[model samples]
Target: MMVQTGLPPMMAKVLVYLFTSDTEGLTAAELIQRLRVSPASISKAVGYLERLGLIRREREGRRRERYIVLDDIWYRTWSVSARSIQLGAGTAQDGVSVPAPPGSTSPISA
Candidate 1:
């Protein structure tokens, strides 16, 4: 299901493991071993989630970065989405005519 939702299988597994585990954070190496995925994959997913603000990374001592899931992650995610929708609605309301191609009506209502 996670793979279908645009997450790699290993990345999804790592996230699930983190969600289930009692630890508040996990290092990349620990996640890699637990999920049995390549370092590159873990790094890529971590980067993506960090950018999305779904997960946070804290720099532990000795150059290690620990990843954690925030309790308000969903609130942040939905807020971003809502903000985007507001922007889109505002743009649509700014007299931008819908450019309907041929017979199809444009989804963006004028």
Candidate 2:
């Protein structure tokens, strides 16, 4: 379901796990262990989620970074998706209309 929203499969999985979990956050090792994915996969997924504003990375005194979902995870996700849709719609509305390809019955001619 989340994959349909432009999130990669791994990223979607990681994000969903973090958002649904009761714990404050999970370290990459823990995520890897729980998700059964490679270390690099978790790293990439978390980085992508963080950049999308869907999750955050926190550090303990001398411990590994943990990834946690923001308090308003759903709202943040919705907002990002809405903004993307808005940008796409604006671009579409601003697009130049091209002449219909030599077909005689088409009404799409610019």
Candidate 3:
């Protein structure tokens, strides 16, 4: 269902895990351990989720960053997107459909 959000596979995977965890949050290290993925991949996926307003980052004490998915995540995401639209912002996907990749003839996946 969430793949329709146009997220990369790993990012989508990360988001699903966070959403279904039934906890307030999880740290990057925890995500890496649970997902068995490279730190860079987890970082990239988590960063993307944050940028999309689908996840929240909380800092605890000195060195921990916890990623949380709210129960009303879709509402929060819509609110953020609505605010951006009202502020005259363009979505990153705005022009994605108009171009074919330079070196490849394959159609871009949705």
Which numbered prediction scores highest in TM-score against the true structure? Answer: 2
lDDT of 1 at 66: 92
lDDT for position 34 in model 1: 82
The whole-model lDDT of each prediction reads: 0.77, 0.86, 0.81
**Candidate 3 — worst ten consecutive residues by lDDT sum?**
88-97
TM-score of 3: 0.65
TM accuracy, model 2: 0.83
Residue 11 error, candidate 1, Å: 4.3
Q: Is candidate 1 or 3 superior in lDDT? A: 3
Q: What are the clashing pairs of model 1?
A: none
Residue lDDT tens for model 3, 1-110: 55664567898889888988867788999999999999999999988888877888899889999999866888976786678666554444554555667777744634
Model 2 lowest lDDT segment of ten: 98-107
The deviation in Å at residue 65 for candidate 1 is 1.2
Please give each candidate's TM-score: 0.65, 0.83, 0.65
Score candidate 1 by TM-score against the native.
0.65
Error of 3 at 54 (Å): 0.9
Candidate 1, which ten residues in sequence have the lowest lDDT sum?
Answer: 2-11
